[model samples]
Target: MDHKGTIVMQKYELGRLLGQGSFAKVYHARCVETGQSVAIKVVDKAKVRKAGIMDHIEREISVMRRVRHPNVVHLYEVMATKSKIYFVMEYARGGELFRKVEANGRLPEDVGRKYFVQLIDAVEFCHGRGVCHRDLKPENILLDEDGGIKVSDFGLSGVAECRGADGLLHTTCGTPAYVAPEIIGRSGYDGAGVDVWSCGVVLFVLLAGYLPFHDTNVMEMYRKISRGEYRFPSWFSPKLKKLISRMLDPNPSSRISIAKIKGSSWFKAGKEGEPVKVTSDGDEARRLLKMNAFDIISLSDGLDLSKLFETESCLDKGCRIMSRKPVAVIVSRLERGARAAKMRVSKKDGGLIELESRDGVLAIEAEISVVTPVLHLVEVRRRYGEAAEYEKVLNEVIRPRLVDKAPSSLLRHQHSLSPSSGARL
Candidate 1:
């Protein structure tokens, strides 16, 4: 939208303005060679420089250049003139996913199952290549006339594989409602784990036509998220609840693995390669996104996660006073030699954690529930910098339960939960 030198698409006739963003404007255009419809995204170099996204824009082009999948959006070609950069992409005939959700109400199980598989397959491909789609939601997923899902909007997408100083990711990026707790806690987290968490949220939205974690007040939502609290209506099946719980685990370490997600009962039960609805005419698979309720708010609007650095969670400091919220815990993990280990230290009581390292890999299930305490207890003390002293209550009342368990048994302790329960802020 902001540019100087003009390179008019004199060959390809430009039509309606499809969309606009901070970086570019997209228009529906017809290719002179084929007379076929295509969407053109024109970006200005000066705007890229002003936003300090020149690197991101290049990374996006490089990433898009390598991706070759039917489920993912295809970039036809790129052209750069002095004033503008061009991205010509295949036009998805169908409309937004959010519009279909709002108009159709809660989709039938079969309908959701079809779309879920498509979305997962797209995500699986990205993960296979060491990429993490930081943003995954209804708005970014497009539908073709045939009801196929086309994953678009790669502006926020980038590789999360840590091959440098820390082998863990700590960027406080992603939409708040769908973000993983490890991200919220400012502890380094596995990129794959956080992506799965977001996918889980998207899955919930597809089936229920509502967000599981919804709050109007920003801080209020943060408080609810901190507590790992969310509610699903009684009418939803128990199986759905189980899946959502695993996806929304308060601890990223505990979130369900993508492998488990693909093999889950919900996904496995659905028909293969089908649309949302199957009719003789095949019109029900995907509803058109044009003029839908979802269009009222462009889904990509909040996707530019660069704004997160403005939060107190900026990575420059060892500890950040996050949004005036009481700093309660410091959670961290180490992965080496096939072992992914985590330790949460009492914030009030600081010292080396004498944790028993697992002989093999960290049990994925335990990582979610148990490791949270390791981080929080230490954070509570670190952020407060207070006189509150921690007591070794576990040894006095809890050591007896270790007799038969793999890890020291915590049932022997008086507290209903292992050290993980009642983790303080």
Candidate 2:
């Protein structure tokens, strides 16, 4: 309410468009009453419903509500209306840590060590809270005005409840370059160990200004990650190299734990096991302290999420299943195979080909994405009337036609509709 007695519909004063994603847009904003700076994430409910990822969004909110560490981004409140959902969060004025790495090429040893400590501390905090940041990368880390670390974007995060009977997460998620070997193995992996591996990769990037696992080939990259076959630069110290080796070990059991990392001589050198001291913003503190638990009921009041559970037209409509064949061969085989199967060809663009079954019972989509000279990924999907029909088409009609001499290891490991949801065939 302002002095004029008229009602103000907008709660925060939106400044600039910070960033935009497929379903949401982030903006720089200021609290109307307190005049404090904040970042507001405005999500389109319609898009969320259409994409069928409302649960992922809710999980993100739930996990963020439980985290209150200095290195983790502070999620203040969640407000919603009929169509839009808003998340008020602490604003990071300094932008993503990626920008810093890009501008400077590589950071000094001391600087890399500093950022590594913060990242580890943040991961430790999240794991302690029964949360795992599945997607850990430089772009997900934000820097405050004082150049301090703040882990953001829990959209791909998983919590304790997601753990399987074996007490490991089976989801294959995260950026390819940073993902652990265990994740690419298609076997269940320990969340904590996975985060540690990603953090180790981030540390390497900070110091070397490039990914440790490098190849024009995705399968080759996975092979390198699986074998723990990355080399440290000449500039890296012996102690740091030793620590990184332990962290990047292919065996999760052999990988260095966060507790061990904290106790390591290299990690404790300058700080002597003392954690970085970051002061909380006054407004942020007040907001967080006032609201402890996430009011999911109130947040979702009057909201209908039934559409989110229904199978809407496939969102993002593609998968990245690895293949070793040349692009020309892969494309030709796909087209010829679709024709041989008597499907009505609809369109072809670059490596993508679309076809519909003659009887109109199913729609087939296929595409090829080249990761390296020798390694490529074939994306395939079939949309049908029911789950059974979809599987029938996949196993009986589609699978046999697309078989290639490419390494079986490619498709055997990484093929899922949505990694976060743990979708598999």
Candidate 3:
């Protein structure tokens, strides 16, 4: 009904505008067919385009699709049209983790420990799947009605092989106070280690109601992070201090891993009932079945797609293609479609077809893998380029062919569409 069009309205009954960020707004919505309450994030493609952060958006989508854990927020579906991108995500009724910390100042040790355990479980699951969440903070964590944790926001996640010669994730991003020493050093930081560091900071804040490293000066903050300089408050249990110290170690190589952390006294003490698994059915399951992590990273250049997909978990890198098309047939059709779009195409091992921008300034790649005798999965990625242009090419040129070649039984086309309740905020 509004200028944004009725595309989102056809499927969802938008309730109220929940919240707004620079490029997107969250709204409470109910599925027209199922009447299920969902948080729909309507991202303004124009705003994202202007800001050149479409890749970040794509990365968030890709990362969320690959992960399925009780502690992680579930991404139900992604729909996009000409104007906006709609992310149908699970509604966390209890709101942001930051709010709880703000109200309580400091949580009870047991409560903080419980949240930390849930966080660890989610982070551990992600790492095992070869995905690293670069940003971990109270603001990014959410709570559900049952007071369970739901880690959200993956705009800064690192998707790749868990361990490779590629060394560290060189990206310098994340909230400064929660960022790791290695990430601040920027000499290339291990994805898992930096993530652990952030988690450590999160744990500290959950228990202490303050950052372990603080400074009015940015330089001082960086210096503190680099030195891993932070004193545990006297109120902290010795066990807690020891565990946090190990997680926040300045030397990433020597930093405590999730496995060791799990075995630690503090972590073990905080353990409780298992995480609550949100039900995935119908469209959610189907979309997840065909979801691939590498597809989202294709816009970046020179990244090794093969290594990332080589993991043992079939569900990790590639989504099952619900079509009957053979791998070769699918690759041929995609290559043909890409060539027609004036993009350069090159065949690679492992059913990969690499694409180069008309001028060879950017690179993108796609692959089709046979997961079972009848089920196949198609995955795409961007090697590296301008985020805005890559998004355009992906949506305008590549996505159509992907949908066209995909079995109609498996994919549905829709316009793009987040979160909250009550009157418009």
Evaluate all candidate structures by whole-model CA lDDT and list the values in order: 0.55, 0.72, 0.71
The candidate that wins on TM-score is: 3
lDDT for 83 in candidate 3 is 63
Candidate 1 overall lDDT versus native:
0.55
- Give the TM-score of each candidate: 0.62, 0.65, 0.68
Could you give candidate 3's per-residue lDDT for residues 67-129 as a string of tens digits?
Answer: 767799988766665566778899999999999999999999999998998899899888764
Q: Which stretches of candidate 3 lie over 4 Å from their true place?
A: 1-7, 161-165, 272-425
TM-score of 3: 0.68
Q: List the residue pairs that clash in candidate 2.
A: 216-372, 323-376
For lDDT, candidate 1 versus 3, the one ahead is: 3
Q: Model 1, residue 11: displacement in angstroms?
A: 4.4
Task: Report the C-alpha lDDT of model 1 over 60-161, residue by residue, as the tens digit.
Answer: 654564344578887775555545667778888786776788888777777787887888877877765446777788888888889988888877664532
C-alpha RMSD (angstroms) for model 1: 19.6
Worst 10 residues of 2 by lDDT: 295-304
* CA deviation > 4 Å runs, candidate 1: 1-11, 160-164, 271-425
